[model samples]
Target: MSSLTVLVIDDEPNLVRSIQFSLNDQNIGLHAAYSGNEGIKTFTTLAPDVVLLDLGLPDQSGLDVLAQLKALSPDTPVIMISAHGDTRTAVKAVKEGALDYITKPFDIDELELLIKRCGEQQRLSKELRFLRSKQIHTQRIIGNSHNIQQLREMIEQIGNSAAKTILISGQSGTGKALIARSLHDIRFNDAPFIEINCAALPEQLIEAELFGAERGAYTGSVQKRDGLISLADNGTLFLDEIGEMPLAIQAKLLTFLENRVYRSIGGGKERKANVVVIAATNKDLKEAVDAGAFRADLYYRLNVVPISAPALSDRTSDIALLVNFFSEQFAKQEGCKPPIWSDDVISQLKTYPWPGNIRELKNLVERITILYPGQTAMPKHLPNEYKQNPASSRTEDSNYSSVVENKERELILSALSQCGGRKGLAAEQLGISRHALKRRIQRLHIDL
Candidate 1:
């Protein structure tokens, strides 16, 4: 382990010397400051793991220094040392955010133990933060196509904004939930991220699950329950498959969305929670609204910041990247080497229309990694659906062809506009060679 840094802010030379001598064998990097201002400056520059601050300073009050230190870095542990360490002063120090208060002539051994404890705590806190960051990065949406890039930019915009209601619309398995989680993780990683699937729950119990239930509200309600909304207070609440939410519950949810307040079942008092609601759905909410299956008002409210996650077929250029990423992830999990994709396998993958989208691609990669570790993945290893109808995979669906063509045309035109109508520059912007860009423009019948 690396050495822990401890900053000591005190005007007493003898006491500073004593601390240095006693902790010399503890393998700690000790830094001393004679005044509060100097201590703040040293703390800012060094960013030490722990601070030993004296209550009596030559320049300023220790309480003021303590507050300033916390304002700079709230997580760094601060211990107060003073000669006049009465109960009242200790209480005051702690109330101002001191981790612990020590009196003068304190036992050297006890002080060393306290420093070690603080060092361990700081290490654990840093580890937890690192793990959280890794988790966020692992769960991020992976793609490089124009549609995917636009989706990512929208996510960042909405994540940084104060928009409380966001709706993610996409086909099944296109990673709607993943986008929702990305938005939450970016801004509210330290807060709760509660997800509830409306399609998974029965209509009769969804209201209770979302808004909680009071004691004796129903046959099974023996005690008061905190629902997902209440649990997600000051955090994010992701409602997946929101189109499956019943109409009655839709009204209640709309009310909550309008005014961050709701009441439990069989309870009279109203409760409020500050939650950001991110809803995802595979079904066409507008069609459902027209059919009277969903409320128009609720749909409008949830669609405050709508984001569309592109299907796998719409972003064929990203298939190889996804394949490699999933292969490595599964290989690490299974304790095996990742499989290499041959040219034939890559070509075959890009041609197939992934109806199951990214979920299907991930599953296929995991299966290949587990069955043929350290081997080259080829077309023969792919499923029969991919091999038998490789050429006709996309042609079979007329609606899909039209959608893909429109998206392709739009992407090409946007690239051309961005590059000032220069074919070579547009090709580079779109991650393709000039010849390929010319072929696409000709095929799409795009005007210059």
Candidate 2:
């Protein structure tokens, strides 16, 4: 802690020397400035942890320097010093964002104590920021349904094995990444887990980026580069959308898997990369193999362990848990009060067929929070597609017209109820964004 830096500004040379002598060995490096101009220059250059500013400076007022420093780095604590004591002046300093102020004849020990307090507060603020960012990825599978429980057990079983390859099959937005992270956290929490979206990467640069290239290996290769695979050595590598990998690259990757070694483009040396591979895909890889797209040999290698993630529609009972989790998460992120999900709204959420799975659910919660603001979520707050559509929830019935009349009546009633009998608000709520809500009420023949 002795390496911590403190910048001191004072017009008096004797006072500056006295402070340096008093605090030299107290876990802080001292920097001195005699004028406001010099103080600003030093503060910008040194980026000190704390600043001790004198209110009276030769070139400019200390308040001016304090304001400038606060604007530059709001987190650095600034303590003001002044000889003339006035309530108004102290209040003004505080308003200008000064952390604290001390008189000219202050004791050395008192000044040191103030500085230490500021340091502790700064450290706490940094830690809080880190924890907030960390929680976004620290979550586990938040469900209690039988399907999810079975999936968890299978994940644990595969995680304890020594198989170097694993494959995860699921539809888009089915929490594939969550399952992958769970497997990694179970086995290699201490080691790095690198992830790459194979579909998002361009085919040309995928090879060089995966396997490192030597200096002068290609036209733009000015320095030797270590690829993501090298970084994942002795760890796990997750390749998402593996079916999108180009055929040429697939052939090279197959070779690399057979012999734990790969040659970079325009380089002759074979680099050894020992990494456990976990690949995920929404496409049917077996169909791709049958069509001569994905290599059959690579498919067998990746099939050492296989796990399938169930779609959200197959497990509607988990919607409430997911909604609550997302609502709390979004509320924290937005810094706004979390909205309440009324029982009616929750029932409506359960009735909808979630085509996009968990991702879609998260998106809907965020949108609901935005529209409802500080109020509770209601049926009228939902978008047009999910407004009391009984037909949409029919899992076995293929007859659409049989349920249309009941759905339309329920939707109009819900809209009117939420809009307080005002047809305009009801119409807008129903996404009929046309004529007045009264006109909609008359058209739907609603009594309200």
Candidate 3:
């Protein structure tokens, strides 16, 4: 990765040069300006990843500079540097939007760690903001089937009410998360909608990531930080795949849901958040609870307003609507004109039982857009799986090899199709070597 561009604004040349040398050796880019006016001017041009502003400057006070820089780019992370290490100064700087306060005699290693942590946090926050804005501006539930209608109605009612917890359950790729986002949108304000995948992180990290951790709370936790729940105060926190959460974390989450109060991993004053937590999963919680994989009490608490997402096969009538919508969407995304779908193609799609549901359909359309943008989508343009008799795609057969081979073939074909017939790119996308991809292609008798 490229180094972080850090702007250092201080009148003291010795400290500025020392930091520049120290960070440069660590592959962190640094820029310096001695006066406040010069610092602000340089900042406008550099737009660095982080700013280190000294409390005392030659031309103006650092507080005035901090205010201007914030007004210019409010999301930029700024750390206040001062000789006075008083708690009052630290609190005032933080209250005025500085990320942290560092005394003049700060350790270089400590500063580096702080810079990395704060920089990474702001980057993640900015990315989430971009994605949320894009979603808010362009995407929504597209189908109008009875199932989708009921979902919209549920979202409307939930949005209008004061429901704090919602449980969305459905098969994989059936847009359970989308439904969560829908619920968020209905009651949308300036509050954030934070999402964390329970299965994505290790058990040890999930608690800290959720409720937060103090300095020295865990290995590598160099600085105190706010968790997703805290960041999402007065907003929404979408817990994706909550069924996969660790048993211990599940217990803690249940407690928080019960009373809105939680303690950090290292233990501090009890904190409270007023965010709506929407948990979604593809698993049957009742079965999980019965099997002892999920807590019964937690399951009951989450299932208060249970919503079941409909599979694509259950709403065959909406196939065409979804396909066309996905086509136009991927087209605009890939910067190509939308492909035209024939009536016969639509009929064939409606016949298939989409095990992966809406997600599979969406991925296929995106592949088509990349492969044959602006062209009419004909039956021949369909993947081999789509061309097969929909009845044969059923999983009722006990032949394990046949099912695995079919799925493998579809996966390879989709990768190749998405990469425009480039073996290297396809292999990369499949997380396999080019040689491996060749062997599979030959073994599977893939014509491509």
- Give the TM-scores of the predictions, in the order they appear: 0.58, 0.57, 0.58
Q: Which prediction has more favorable lDDT, 1 or 3?
A: 1
Task: Give candidate 1's error at residue 241 in angstroms.
Answer: 0.3
**lDDT per residue as tens, model 1, 274-374:** 99999999999999999999999999999989999898999998787678778767866654446667657877888788888999889779767754554
Tens digit of per-residue lDDT, candidate 3, span 92-202? 665576777788689999899778755754554454444345435123676657876776677778776888999999999999888888788778767799999999999
RMSD of each: 25.3, 19.2, 23.3
Clashing pairs in 2: 423-437, 424-437
lDDT of each: 0.82, 0.76, 0.80
- The parts of candidate 1 lying over 4 Å away from their true place are 1-139, 391-448
Clashing pairs in 3: none
302-415 in candidate 2: lDDT tens per residue?
A: 887899999998888777667766766775554443455656777887888777888988987876653443345778877656667756644543343334435566777887
Those runs of model 2 whose alpha carbons end farther than 4 Å from true positions after fitting are 1-139, 390-448
Error of 3 at 235 (Å): 0.4
Clashing pairs in 1: none
The worst-scoring run of ten residues by lDDT in candidate 1 lies at 130-139
Q: Ranking by TM-score, best first?
A: 3, 1, 2
What's the TM for model 1? Answer: 0.58
